[model samples]
Target: MTVLSSSSSRFPYAKGSDGTRRLGYGADYNPEQWPREVWEEDVRLMREAGVNIVSLAIFSWARLQPTAETWEFGWLDDVMDLLHAGGIGVDLATATASPPPWLTAAHPEILPVTASGATVWPGARQHWRPTSPVFRDHALRLVRKLASRYADHPALVAWHVNNELGCHNVYDYSDDAARAFRVWLRRRYEHLDALNHAWATAFWSQRYSDWEQILPPRLAASHPNPTQQLDFKRFSSDALKNHLRAERDILRELTPHTPVTTNFMVMGGTKGMDYADWADEVDFVANDHYVVHGPRDEGARDRDELSFSANLTGALARRRPWFLMEHSTSAVNWQPVNLPKKFGELARDSLLHVAHGADAVCFFQWRQSAAGAEKYHSAMVPHAGADSDVFRSVVELGRTLEALAPLAGSEREPARVAVLFDWDSWWAAEHDSHPTARLDYHTEALAWYAALLRLGVRADVVPAHGTELDGYDLVIAPVLHMVPQTLAKRLTRYVETGGHLVTTYFSGIVDEHDHVWLGGHPGALRELLGIRIEEFGPLADEDTVGVDAGPAGELTGDLWSDRVDVTAPDVEVLARYRTGTYAARPAVTRRAAGRGTAAYVSTRLGVDGLAALLPELLAPAGVTSELPECARGAVEPVVRRDADHRYLFLVNRTDTPVDVPGVEGEVLAGPAVRADGRLSLPPRAVAVLRGPNR
Candidate 1:
C-alpha cells in the first residue's frame, strides 16, 4: 500500500507520501446516483478540469448497509480504486449522514420532534435526534466498519464524518430530548436550586424540585424561561458535537494518520450549532455557503454576505486556511427564487473564498442530479455538459487554483480590528422576551463588519468569550447581549491597557446563565463605558430616532434606543437624541479609562450611520484604511501575506468601474493590468496583486 503522508502546509490539505502539495478541487462524488459507465466519464472530466480531490459516500448509508446486519462495500471499493487509478484522492465519508430506512423504521423513537410537537419524518436527511443512544450505536457501528475498511486504502486522504450534521434537525423536543436535557442541566447547574434560580422560575411558579421534572423548552404557556431556552440551545449544539466526537474517536483509533472533518453550514440560515466550540473536534474546518438572493439590490449585498461568511469561517479556524466544501456553480435550488450567477461570478466567488483563506474549493456535486430535491442545483458538469460556460469557468478556476497553489499555507494579513461574534449571545439575544424582536445578533454584527469592510479595514469575526483580545487595536461588539463576568473583565482590561472598544445597545446585560447583573443596565460595562442605562426604550418597527452628532450632522437609527445617564464626568457625549421624550440625552458616549478608550452606541445604527461613525472611532486606535479615500466604499481590499510576498485582493462591488490608486504590484490574477500606481477595476471584478511585503 502506498501511504499518503500529510502536508506541512499551514492549511489542511490531503497530502501523499511523495511529499507533493496538491490543491483540492472537484466536488461531492455520488457514484451511487449514477451507473458504473458514467463513473468513468466523471473521472475523465475531473482530470480534465485539474481536479485532485472528491468527497465520496456522503449520503450512501442506505446503499452501503441494506439491512440491520448486512453490509456492502463492493460498489464503494470499485469507485475508490477507479479514483486512485485516475490520480485523484478521496475524502471518504463514513456514510452515516443519514440512517438506513430499516434502522429508522425499527426505532421510530430515535426520530426528532419539533417544538410544536410535530414529528420530523425520516424521509428527509438528518432526521434523527442527536441525543438518541440507539442512533449513536448504529452510527458508530457503521463508522467503525468504514474506518477499518478504508484505513489503508491508497486513495483515502481524509474522513468526512457526516454530511452537514444537524442541518435539518438541530433542535429536537421529544421525550428523549427532555431526558437528555435534564442530564445536561444537571451537569451544568449541578443542583436543582441553582437551575431554578438561574432560570428565575420563581416568577412563574415553575421551579423544579427534581431533575426529572425538567424538560426541553417545549410549547409553553407564555414564553419559556429565557435561561432554560438558552441552555437548551447549548445542549443541542453539544449533542451534535458529541456525535461528531464519537465518530472522530472511532476514526482516530482505527486510522490515526488520516484527518477527519465535517461540513458546517456557517451561512445565514444556520443557528444552534456553535462552530467555534466545534472547531477543535475536527482536524480542519469545512464550510458550505451560498449566495443569498431575493434582495432587490443584489450585487453589494451578495458580495458582503460571501465575504462575511468566508471571513467568519476563517476566524473560526483560527485564521488557518479552511475548506470551501460546498457552493453552487450556478443557481441554488433552495432559495425563495434561485438566480443564476452572471458570466464572471463563478470565478469571482471561488477566488473570493481563496482570498479569505480557503485552501480548497469544492462544490456540492460533480454532475447535476437528474432526480432528488437538489436536482436543479448547479454542478461542475452542468446539464449543458463540458462545452457549457459553467464547465469552462470550472476548468478556468482549476487552472487559476493551480497558479495560486504557492499561496496554500499563507494566512490573512493580521487584522487590527476584531468583531465579537458569539453564538450563545446570538441565541440569547434573539430569544422571545428580548427588548425588541427585531434585534438580530448577526445582523447587528454584520452591520458593523460591513462598515469596516467598506472602510477597507480587514476585521476578524472572533468569539465573544475566551478569545484573546491583546493583539487587536480596535474591538467592536454590536449587541453583545450575554456578556459573562469573565468576558466583561477581559474587555475592561483590554480597554484599560490601550485597546479601543466600541459596543452597541443591549450589551453587558447578563451573565453566562442569562441572569441580569443588577444595578443599571449595560451591567458589567457601566464603569468602562461611563454610562448607565436607566431604561430601555424599544422603538416600533416603523419609528426612527434622530441622533445629532454636532459636526457630523444628524443620523437616523432604529430598532432600539437606550435612555443613557452619563455616570462619569470624563465620559464625552459624542451624539445625542435630537427628538423624543429622551431628547438631548446621550445616544453615543466615549470614556477614557487608564490608557485606552471605550465607546458605547445606544441604538441600532444602520450601515450608513456606522460608516459615518467609524472614522472617529478608528482614529484613536491609529488604524487607517489602505485604499484611497475616494475608493473606500466603492471597492473592498483584503490583504493576505506569506513570508515572501503580500497579495492584495481588491474586489469591485459596484456596477461602474472604480480606480484604486497608489497600489503598485505585479498582477497575479484577474483582468489586464499596467505598471502604473493605479488600476481600474471593472464591475464586479476581482483583482489579485502580488507585491513586496512592505
Candidate 2:
C-alpha cells in the first residue's frame, strides 16, 4: 500500500479495443500454465466471454527467466501479440511476484524469518522479505526489464506492479527487517528519548540507550510490550509500502505513460497492510477481495461482509472508481470447506462491487488449473469447461458490465451516514493484556454495518484517519480506542459543527502510543459524550446482560458492559441495564453538544440489538432511509452518480423473491420494472435503476 494522499490526475479507466472507455471485465490470464495450442483456445474463450482485459504473467518469474544467464521472451512476446490481435488488452505484470528458484537458491538469506526463527522456504509464493535489499535489487532488475520490453506494446493498458504483496510475507523477523525498523523509527521519532517516551519503556525496564537495541516484537518468553507490538505493525506495513514505491518508480520511469498498480488484500483477517495509507501510490486503487468462509457467518451475512469490504475500498479510493482485481467465479480453494456459489450468487456478487464503485470486475483466473494448489478454485472457465453453468454466468456478467458501460466512470454518491474504520485502533485494541480477550474490533464494526443494512440505510465505510468529516451528517466510529490529540480535536470539532456521532464501547481509551488516558475509562471522549465509566465489566462467554430501552423491547448484550455515570447536566440515558451486576445503570447515553449531539453505547450490542436502537438515535438528525417503507430491509440500496443521473442498485439479500414498491426508474439490468413502478427481484439478484440525479 502507498501513502494516503489524493491523486488528482489518475488514469480515468482502461479503454476498449473500439477506442471507447468501458468497465473492465476479465480474469488473471496465466497462459504460461498451458501448452501453446491452449493459448489460442484461451483467447477464443476470452472473446466469447466478452473479456476486454487480462492481467498476464502474475507468477511467471521462473518461466520468464529460467536461469540467471537465460532470457525467455519469445513465448511472452507471442502471447502479448496474440491478445492484442484478439482485441483483449493486457494488464502486464512485472513477473516478480515470486522469486525464481535459481535466485533463491543463490541468496537464501532473502527469505523471510518467522517470529519463532523459522525460515519460510520457497515452496509457496511471496517468500522474499520486504526489507531485504538483495531481494529488492533482484526484483527491481526484473521490473525494469519487463517495463522496458512492454513499454511500446499496444496491448499494455496498465502495469501490474506485483501480485498481492505482503499476503504471505508481511511479518519478517530477520536482520534486514530489524535494520529497517530502526531506520523507520529514526524517521518517525528523531531521538531515542522521544522513542522511549512514546513506547513507555520505563514500565518494562526496557528503556533503550541506543537505536540498535530496539527490535521487532519477535517471539519472547512472555507477552511483549504493547507499544512495541503496535510500532512493529506500523513498521511492517511501511516496509511493504516502501517496496511498492520501489517497483512503481521503476515502472513509471521506464513507461512514463503507463499507470502502475498493485493488488491489495482488503478482505477478512489481512490486517498487516494499511490500505488507506497506500492509496495515493497507485494510479487507481486495486483490491483483491474473497468472501471469507467459516465461523464469521454465511449467505446474506457473507454478502453483507463483502459489501462492507467494498465500501471501505471505495473510501480508500476517495469514492473514485477502483479496480476489483481478484474475486471468485464460483468456489475458492483456500477456505476449509469450499462451498460452490449458488445460482445467482456469481453475478449478484460482481454487481454489488460495481454498485459500491468498482469500475473493473475480474476473477482470480481465466482458466481452471490442470495441476496446482488452486486446481479446485473456480475460474471464468471451470474444470468442466465453458459449457458449465459457471462460464454461462460469466458470459451473463460480462453482458451486464457492457450494459453498465454508461456508468463506468461515475463517482460513488456520498451517503449521509458514514462508518469510520481505524487501522491504528484495530492494531492496538486487539493487543495482549486488554480487559477482555473476546473483544473483536472488526466484529463490532461489522455488526453496525449489518444493522445499517437491516434498516436500509446507505452508509460509506471510510477510513477513520484523515477523512473529510463534514461530508457526512452522521458518523459512526466503533472501537475507536487509539485516539490521538489530533483525532480527538477533529472529532470534537465535527460534533460542535452539527455532526451527529455514535460511538461504541472501548472507544477513546488510549492515545497513539497505546498509553491510557489517565482520568478514567473511555478517556478522550468522556467529555464530549458526557459520560464517565469507572471500569469495564466484561462478561463470561456464556453470560448475557439484558438491556432495557424503555419503549423498545429488551435486548441481550454479551462480551462487554460498562458501569456508566452521567457527568453533563443535559445528558440523557437512553437505555439501562435491566439485569446485570450493575443493574439499572446507564447502558446508553446521549448529550447535546453545540448544534449536534454525541451518543455512546457501553455494551456489545449485536446486530439486532443495535438495529432496535438506531431509529431513536437517528430521528433527531433526520437521517432516515430514502427507500420506501415496504422495500427497506429486504433490499440493500447503493447509489452512484454522474453528470446527468444517479444509478440505484437494488440488491435482494434474501433467498425468496422480494417486491420493492415505489422504485421508479428505467431498468438497465436484471428483470423489468412492474407497471406499478415496483421492483420484483429474484433471489440473490441485483437490479440497476437509472433515475434523475437529485
Candidate 3:
C-alpha cells in the first residue's frame, strides 16, 4: 500500500543551499548526451544563466540500464555530484519513460497495441503498455534501483514520475488493455445490471453478461458505443495514473522528504489526461505547455491559449505556486513553419506563466541536442551556443526573475469571474458521433477567455470538477456537455445563492454516462436557462448566422445556431437570430432564478462576438477592468498577492509601444517607469508592479 504524504509539508519546494526559497529557473538537463569535456562547460553556462534547478535523466532509461542483468550508476552519480557542485538542484526523473531495447526485445508484448491491433514499435518514446505487468515489474525494479542509488544525493530536490504520461501511448486495445479495462469496469460498476444500465447496452446489443466478455472500444463496423469510449478514456488515464503511482510510491518509500511530480501537458488539443483529477496525486502540480501555431487566424489563438492553459494550471494547483516543467525558448521543430518568437515574445511568455502562478520556469532542454528527434527543438542554449540571441534572452529573463524574487511564495489573486473548464465535456462532446464534428471545446473556451482579455477583465480559467463556484459572482461554463446529477444540483444551488452563470449551446445535454437528459435540449440546464430546444441546427462549413441584439448591436457567428424557445415567463430574449429558419427567434436568453440570473448563447460566436456579448453580462455583475482606460484592451493584468503586497503583472498584447497611465505601484522587473508617473511597454512585453495588498 502507498502511504500519502502531507502536501502542506512540501511547500516552498526546491530551495537554495542556504535554505532560502527563490523561484527555480532551469531546464531539462540531459548531461548524459554530452561528452565529459562538454559537461564542465555546461555547468559554467548554467551558473551564468542563473540556473538553480534542472530535471535530470528524464529519457535515460536505456542508458541507465543497458541490459536486464547489468546496472549503470557511475555516470548518473558523476552528473549528480557535478550539478550539486555547480549550485544546481535536480528534479530527478524515474527514467521509466521508455523501456530498454533489451527489455522490449525479450518481452514484445509489453508494447502498446493500437485500436486496430497493430503493435506500437520502439522507435519513439513511451512505447510500453501502462497495464502490462511485465512492463510494470521491470519499470518498478529500475525505479527501486535508481531511487536507492540516489536517495541521499544532495542534488536531488524532487522526483519526476514519468515524462508526459499519456503523450503518444495513452490508448491501448490489446488483450492486456481489455483485461485491465474489464477489471476497472468491474471495480467501478460492481454489478452487471448497473453496468448494463450505465452503458445503455440494450440498443445495439453490447450488454455484457460476464465481466470478462467486455473489451476496449476497438475498431467497429459503425461508430462504437459512446459510453464505452468514454469509459475507455477514463480507464486509460487511470492506467497511466496507476503507473505514475507505482513509481512515485517507490520514491516516497525511500525518500519521504523529497516531493514527487509528473509533468502535465496542459496545452491545446492535448486532452488525453485529466490533470485536475491527478492534481493531489503529486506534491505540486507541474505542467508542460507549448504554444501551437495557428493557420486560420494567423496564430491569434496561440498567446491566448497559452494564457488560458497557464491559468487552468494555476487552478489545478488551487492557486498555489506550481512548476512550469517545459516550454520553448524560440521556434520549435514540431510546427510546420517553425518560426522563431518575435522580439520581446520570449520574456513575455515566461512572465505570463509566472503571473499565472508558476514558481519554477523551465524548458525542454538545457542545451540544444547535437542529434535526436528533438534536435531542432529550441532550448536555453541553442545550436549556435551561448553567444546566440536565445541565450542572451535567457540571461535577460534570469536577471528579471532575480529582480522578482520576492514573488516566490505569493498566490494568484482571485478574480471575481471564472471560466470553467471540463475534461469530461471536452472528451464526450467531441466523441466520434457528435453533432457537426466541428465542435471544439478548447476553441470555444478560448473564445470566452480571449473575450475577457479583450475587455481587460481578469477571469481565472479553472477546472469545473472540485472547484468552488461560490467564490465568483459570474461563472462562465462553455460547452459543459457532461453534467451529472450532483453537478446539476451544485450549479443550481450556486445560482440560487446569487451566482450568475453564462453557458453556450450544446451544454448540459448529456449525463456522465453519455445518455441524453429526458427533457428538452440543453437538457439539464434548460430550466435554469429558461430556454428549451427540440433540435440542433448546426451549420455547414461555410454557413454564417446574424445575431441581433437591440441597441447592443448585431454579431456574426458560425458552426452552431440552435432553435430556442423561452420556457419561463421571467426569461428575457437578450438577442435573436436574424437569418435562417429560426429567424427573429431567441439567439441568446437570460432568466432570473432566485437571487441570480442565468444566461445562454445559442450559437458559436467567435472571439469578437463573445467580446461584444460579454459587456452586457458583465455589467450586471459589476465587473470592470483594473487597467486604465487607455490600456484596457491592449494590456493583460494578473495579480499575485503575498502577505503584505500584491504583485500586478501587466502584459502587452500589441506590436507597438503602449502608454499605461494611472498605474500606481512600484515598478519591479518590467518596462521602465517614466518621470510623468506613467509606464510604457514595448510590443509583447511584461511589467511587474508592487502595491499594498489591502
Candidate 4:
C-alpha cells in the first residue's frame, strides 16, 4: 500500500523532474507602482526573508497596454531584470484573463451578460465572454506575446496564464456564445436525441428536432429551470476550459519545458472547468486561499482556516504537492473583522499546508499594497518598510528554513485512509429536486474529514475512480451519490475482505450517468451496508436529535435524519435518535464482515460525537491522537515514519499560543522547545519535528 519512497532531498522543488528548488515565496511586485530606485531595497528585503520566487505581471493588463492596438513592456521588463539579478525567479504571467478596458469597449461582445438579463460593463477582471471568438483571438495573441518575450529568459520558471478564471460567474449569452454552445453541445451528444436523454428534456417537452433549435442556457427567459441551469453550468465550465486549453496549448508549444499552471480559487463549487482535467494538461497545480479572521456564517473561523483550504487544495492535486500561490500575511481588507495574524499564527498556517502536502509557501505581496482592492491586505513590509514587526517575523522564518534544507522536499508519508470526494456528486446532488437544500456534499465530506483529522491520521483526499480501495485500511465515502460502477465493485471487494468502511447518508444513490440506482437506497451499496432505507426524515433548520450511546456517544446536529431496517446477519445498532416519532430509531450501525467492519451514520453529529467515534475506528489500527486537547481552533500535528527517520509536523492553527509536545528543531523558528519538556509554541507556527526512527 506504500505509494512512493523517494529520498525527499532529490525532490526539493516538488518537481521530481524540473530539478529546481520547489520551496519559495510569492509576491505581486508592481515595480511600476513603486519607484525604480526602491527595487534594490525590496529585493534585499525579500532575500533577507528567505524569498526565492515571485509571481509577476498579475493585474498588469493596463500597464502592458494602456490603449487598444498598443503594447508597453518597459516597466515589467525592468522588474524581471531586477528580480533575476537578485536570484529571485519569476512565475511569468500572461495577464490574459483580464482585457484592457478599450478592448472591451471596442468589442462589446467581450463583456459578460448576467443571468438576470443585464449586460455587465468592464472595470473588474475575468469579465470577458469565454466563448467569444474575438475575445479568444485577442487574449491568445497577448498570451503568445508574453510567451515569446519571456520564454527564453533565464529568470522564467513557470508560466501563469491569467490570474484566476471565472472570477465572475456566467457570461455573455450574446449571439456569439449561443452559437458556440450549440456547436459544442452538438459535438458532445452527436444527435439531439442523445442530448435530450442526458438532459431529461423529454419531461418538459423541450425536445429539439434540429441542431439550430438548441440555444445557450440563458437566465433571461428559460432561467431557473433545473435542467437548463445544470446544462449552463456545464457549458460555461467547458467554455472556460476551452479558453484555458487554447492558452495551455500555446504555452506547451512555445515554452514546452517550464511547467505552466494557474492559481485555482478556494472551494470553487463546480463552476465547470475541471481542475483535474486542467491538471492533466498543466505540469502541476497551484492554488490561492485567503481565509480571514472573521465569521461569515455560523461556522467556526477555524473551519475555513484549516479544513476548507486543505480540502480545496487536497481535492485539486492528490498525489503531488500544490503551491500555496497566495495568502495574506496580515489582515485582509475584504473581511469585516480584519484582525491581523497573532504572533505565530501565520507560520503555523504555512506549515499546515506543508503537513497536508504543500510544495512551497508564499504571501500575496512582499512589499505593502500601494493601491487598488488589495491595498488593505497585510504584507511582509508595512508601508513603514523594514521597521515593521511583520517584516522581522518574515526574516526569522526565513532563517528557520535556511537551517532545515537538509529536510527539504520530505513529505508526510501517512497511513492508509482514503476519503472519496467527487465534483460530479457535488454538482449533481445539489441540482437534485431532493427534499432538503441543506444536503451539501462538501459539508458532509468535511464532517467526515474533521473526524479523521482529529485522530492524527494522514488521509489522502482522492476521487473514487482514482483510488484503489485495497490500498486503504479504511475507506470513507461521505455523501457519495454518483457511485462509479467500477468503484462500487472495488469497494464491494474491500469490505468482503473485511476492510473497515464508514459511509454516511445520500451515498450510492446515483450512478455515473446521473441516474438513480433503485432497489432500496444506495443502489449497489445496499448489500454491503446491509440496510434498506425505508425513508429519510428531514430535520427543520432549528431542530436537532442526539445520540448518547453506541461505539461513540452523545452526537447532535441538525442533519437529514433517516430510518433504516438492518438486513445483514452481523449488523448491530449502535446509536439511536432521541427525538420525534422516529425516536429510538437506529442512527449509527456497525456490521461485522470477514476481517473488518462497516459502519453507517444516518445523520450529522456534533464534535462530541466525532470525538467518540474516531477513537474507536483508530483503536484497532493502534493509532492514537498525539495531542488530545489541542488549543481551541488549533489542528493537531501528525507524525509519520519510514525505515530511517521519523517526521513530525507541528501545525499551529490558532491565533494564540498552541503549545504542543516534542520538538527538536523546526524548518522555521529554530529550537521551538528545549529538551526540558516545556512545550511552547508561537501563534501560527510550523515546527518540523525530526528524530531517529524507533
Task: Show how many residue pairs clash in every candidate, following the order shown.
Answer: 0, 4, 0, 9
lDDT of 1 by residue, 1-694 (tens): 0001223323447333566555678799999999899999999999999988899999999999999989889999999999999989898998888888999899998899999899988787988999999999999999999999989999988889888988888999999899888888889889889988889899878988888888888997789888889999999999999999999999999998888899998888588799888887888888989888746753366777788889888777766678898998999998888899987788778888888888889998899999999999999998889999999999988987877766666778768898988898898888897778888887788888888877877787777765778889999998888888788888999999999999999999988988888999899898889999988999998899999976667989899899999999989899999977678999999999988999999988887788788888898899988789889878777778778889888888777888887877778777657567788888778888888887
lDDT per residue (tens digit) for residues 222-329 in model 3 = 999899999999999999999989899999999998899999999999988988888888988899998887886643678889999999988888788899999999
Q: What is the TM-score (0 to 1) of candidate 2? A: 0.98
Model 1 steric clash total: 0
Q: Cα deviation of 133 in candidate 3 (Å)?
A: 0.4
User: Candidate 1 at 596: error in angstroms?
Assistant: 0.9
Ranking by lDDT: 3, 2, 1, 4
Error of 1 at 60 (Å): 0.2
Candidates in order: C-alpha RMSD to true structure: 3.4, 1.8, 2.4, 3.7
lDDT of each: 0.86, 0.89, 0.89, 0.69
Candidate 4 regions off by >4 Å?
Answer: 1-22, 170-174, 220-228, 268-273, 292-308, 311-315, 593-596, 617-623, 626-635, 638-646, 654-673, 676-679, 692-694
Consecutive 10-residue window with the lowest summed lDDT within model 1: 1-10
Error of 3 at 96 (Å): 0.4
Q: Model 4 misses residue 563 by how many Å?
A: 1.7
Q: Give the TM-score of candidate 1.
A: 0.96
Off by over 4 Å in 2: 1-5, 12-14, 17-19, 295-299
